[model samples]
Target: MGKKAEILERLGGIAPALRRYSRALCAGAGHTLSDELVQSALQSVGARIRARELRPADLQEARLEAYAALTASAGKRLTDASRPTPRHPPIVHGLAELSLDDRAALLLVSLEGMGYDAAARVLGIRREALLAQLMRARAKLGVVGLPPADAESGARRAASHLRIVK
Candidate 1:
């Protein structure tokens, strides 16, 4: 097959993961938020591919690069975006409220499924700094939007299921 076909195939394979990351980025913020970011990211990736500016070593790299680009763009965008929407979960809302560096640091590690080293590389920060930022972000998230009392019992039930059988 042709190079274009190959690229298309690679993009198709990574689409689900991209969607997941985008969803995680804006989880509970609103359904369309992630979709918008994904579209914007895809547009950027397509342009780069057409310009031959980005070279993917393999399908996975292509996916990673695409994700990196999106995360970077979204990080920048989040700062200028408006106030917290009700649809946003407490955790996701807190993330959105953070500075781009902190938000990107946390999302790249947690939502993007990237390790500390990889996230640091993407954020251009030292690994230790990234970890510290992630810690602060998580702590801030915990303090925001405490869950309702009604959810506690459900959480306990879910926790109980994790008990291992000997």
Candidate 2:
């Protein structure tokens, strides 16, 4: 297969994981917030591809670019008031308190099972920077690994209430 085709295939495999991550990021499903973000990211990538700003060979870069687009538009998706109210476990509350990047890093690592190197690439940061972000996020959340207590389910429930109204 061609490079772009290959990249598209990769996107297919990772899309579900991205959706789960999105659910976690928006604090729980939020209408189709994650889908919207992924779609927006695709459009952004398409534009870049047309402009020759992104080469087919740069699939990883494209992934980063698309995710950055998703993240850039996250604030709007996170503020809708119509979504279901999520239950707040201590972890969810703690996650809510983190910066967007920190939350992304923590979720990507702990929840999504991404290695620091891969997560860092997705975040467009150096590995060391990703590690720091993870550490700070974990410290804030008060856990080293995924906590299986009320925090885990609470985070999911709380995330659902975040209505990404767009």
Candidate 3:
């Protein structure tokens, strides 16, 4: 495969995970914000590639960078009006109790099935820091499963119901 193709292939392999992670990063902000975050992150990655700042070999790093940057940016951009009452009230309640960093760590490792080191890289944190956040998240999650399967299905159903406006 050519360099561009090889890089895109690597990104494609993790596209679903990246989407999942992006939404979970700021779950309380509502799907609209989370979806936009993913779009922005993808555009950022493409921009970097076009600028020749990101080489094909840096796909994994780029993926991590994109996610981390978007998460941070989302924190700043999220507004009170944009905040939705957590749809799964109970689950969202539990997650709401944890810090954003903790939630991100927990979801990256448990929700996305990422290894501790990989999750840390994505968060731009040390493995030890990731472990601490993960531990905190796990404790909080005892009350709320990290990746609520039903929540995901509900999201998918909602997406299916969306109609394009002319």
Candidate 4:
């Protein structure tokens, strides 16, 4: 294949993961916005690749670059004052409550399954800072281990609200 075709192929391989990450990143913003973010990231990466500004040595490197681009795009969107707030699911609302840095840290590690070093590189932060962000994000999301009694009651209360529909 030609160089352009090869680049396209490489990008295609990582597109699914990018979509998933974008969805998680834009959780409360709706799928349309998430999809737009993915498209924007793809275009940015493509341009860089064509301009010889970003030359990935491997698929993993390419994926990280794409993620970094998407995260940057998400940050820009979050800072736009004219953007309207929309209602989202409880879990999405919880994610939206997090600061951009906290959300990016939490999602990159937990949702994208990136290592601390790789995720830190993507966020342009040190490993220690990344760990601190992860801790703060987890604490904010109430991801701590609850006591046995509280766990049982919390589980029961959560289960009580469940309904089965045919």
Predicted structure with the largest TM-score when compared to the true one: 4
RMSD of each: 6.8, 6.3, 6.9, 6.0
Ranking by lDDT: 4, 3, 2, 1
Per-residue lDDT of candidate 2, residues 1-166 (tens digit)? 8776666656545555556566667654464777877676677777767677777565665666666666667756676342335554445455566778898887777675667887887787899999999778767665533343356565664334322212
Most accurate candidate by lDDT: 4
Indicate the TM-score of model 3.
0.72
| Candidate 4 lDDT score at position 16 | 76
Name model 1 segments beyond 4 Å from true. 2-5, 27-29, 79-81, 145-166
**Residues 1-166 of candidate 3: C-alpha lDDT, one tens digit per residue:** 7776667556656656666776666656666777777777777777777688877566777677677767777667765454437454444556556677897887666566678888888778899999999777767666554342246565453222211100
TM-score of each: 0.69, 0.65, 0.72, 0.77
**Which residue window of length 10 is worst by lDDT in model 1?**
157-166
Best-first order by TM-score: 4, 3, 1, 2
lDDT of 1 at 34: 68
Runs in model 4 with CA error above 4 Å? 2-7, 79-87, 143-166
Score candidate 4 by TM-score against the native.
0.77
Residue by residue across 1-166, what tens digits does model 4's lDDT show? Answer: 8755586577877777888777767755666877888888888888888888888776677778889999999988864332325544454555666788987897888667789999999999999999999888767666523211246456554322111100
